[model samples]
Target: MAVQASPQTLAPFLIEPRFVPRVWGFDDLRPWFDWSRFEKGREAGDPLGEVWLTGDDCHIATGPYSGKILADVIAQEPRAILGPVAPRVESPLLIKVIFAREKLSVQVHPDDKLAQKYGDPRGKTECWYALDSQPDAQVAAGLKPGVTMDQVRAGIQNGTLEDSLNVLPVERGDMIFVDAGTVHAIWPGSILLETQQNCALTYRMYDYGRPRELHIEKSLEATRLTTRAGKVLPVSRPDRTILVDVEYFRVERLPVRSQRSSASLAASDEPGPGLSYLFAAAGSARLTGEGFEPIEIPARGLVCVPAVGSAFVLEDLGGLDLVRMSPRWPAAI
Candidate 1:
């Protein structure tokens, strides 16, 4: 994980995929990536909920960084691997491909203030980018207008809590932001790319007759009763477009065509020191820089690119569509 390289010498590298099972999950994942390669311990009928693209424990899959975990890379070469924007040596963002076959639990996350009070480092604020969806697929975001905590408690007791939620229909390419304190749930048949804070602290309020533990009091304390509206409508752009920009992270959608040369992908001027994550949603590409060999990234693959004074480019792109994620300081915004 530790590489004795300067920031300018760093190259983009791929991470191993981690498949996670859940009760409300899909048996097959399609149109995003093939799930056949990941059926070792899981049976054909077992539900697979998530594919974690990058994490502290995820192994580097390519280049000299191969066989190293992300956490070790950060610890050994914090600045050269993470650049100037990283808040700490550790990665600040977590990315996942979520497939929901059934409704997720009605849950809420505490804000940073509440999280610190509970002895955690930070709270969770996440955004979902819809990759594919079945008909009638929707998400319960926030609470209904004029709804009160008393009413929410009553509905939960009577099993009518969903009626008090603001359900929003979803389709391909739609972006939905879920801030901390917003009560939310992902409905069935939705495949989404979720980007969020590294923390996994969720306070569940209800779970639709499942025998899961309920954090009723904690959820009530975290929930913001006002109408939960966090959808981000992206504007039309030719090359790159900002999807969501929050204090935790900024996400951008970038398109590349085979017609464009590698030089076209690079900035007109050299980029300053920074680190960014790239996810290839469609097609394939090769990441190239001055110091390393071109790293081929398959469709639906993820890459972490760290730049010092120079920038990296997506060469040999065959109509690739990418999602770029970068961390941001809350104080700057």
Candidate 2:
């Protein structure tokens, strides 16, 4: 049973990352994350592939909400965690660090309309920020120009779906957007920071004889011949780099070589909502503010700040490269 007591005393705090095992993952997630920092048995005898930063199962690592499930905290203080003008949703964003040693299944994600038709909250539309990549690293997004649905079906059946994929080379610091309804796949040689809608409704089109269930019918129905899925150019500023400002999320990259206010340290704070995520992509950072215990974010670690919560200051313990992520709602909703 979970404690239902009010955790209003909670301030901006660290979020424990959840490591999920995958067939195509690496045995060790190094340089980026300290595998020992995570609890045991998470690997499950398989190579770990993903580190979910803001997942619902992720527990609060500090302050009043320490040891509480992320979902429970949000449910108890929706307005405080989701902001005053944000949508009424369980989770605003699912931030993850993907470590793929091989290739993921050729998949497609349903859009909002298709997802809602199947009694789901919303669909997935993700953007990837490449943190590290080897030479010739690649990802497949959408289909080759002039490729038809019939060809896709035939390719999947004949096990040649890769031929129809529109492959893109990945480089460090690149931003790639994958919209809903676009068939996509993640390949090896790159470390990715993925920001997406909270929903995880993936429709796998094809897997390389991996014994995984394939969602052929749903994937076909969700596939689109053309989508706005490709490399997105980022705008660089003196203090931060604006990565993506899509309908569901806003992401920014900040360089903190010294101390700064949480307002200036993070993105989309101050005159707006209170919810935000500060990810230490490179070095270490320490967060301090009134009414809350100070918390430190190590390399590849994530921290969450609630809406209207306590104000804080981010001090750079080393070469801190932070990625600030937050949510935005659509007008029609």
Q: Tens-digit lDDT track for model 1 on 300-322?
A: 89988754423456754676878
Cα RMSD for candidates in order: 3.6, 3.2
Q: Model 1 segments beyond 4 Å from truth? A: 1-8, 35-45, 259-272, 307-310
Clashes of 1: 0
Q: Any idea what lDDT model 2 has?
A: 0.85
lDDT of residue 102 for candidate 1: 86
RMSD of 2: 3.2
Find the candidate with the highest lDDT and give its number.
2
Model 2 per-residue lDDT tens digits across residues 256-319: 7688786675444434755789899899989888877789888888988787577788899988
| Residue 56's lDDT in candidate 1 | 79
In candidate 1, residue 160 scores what lDDT?
85
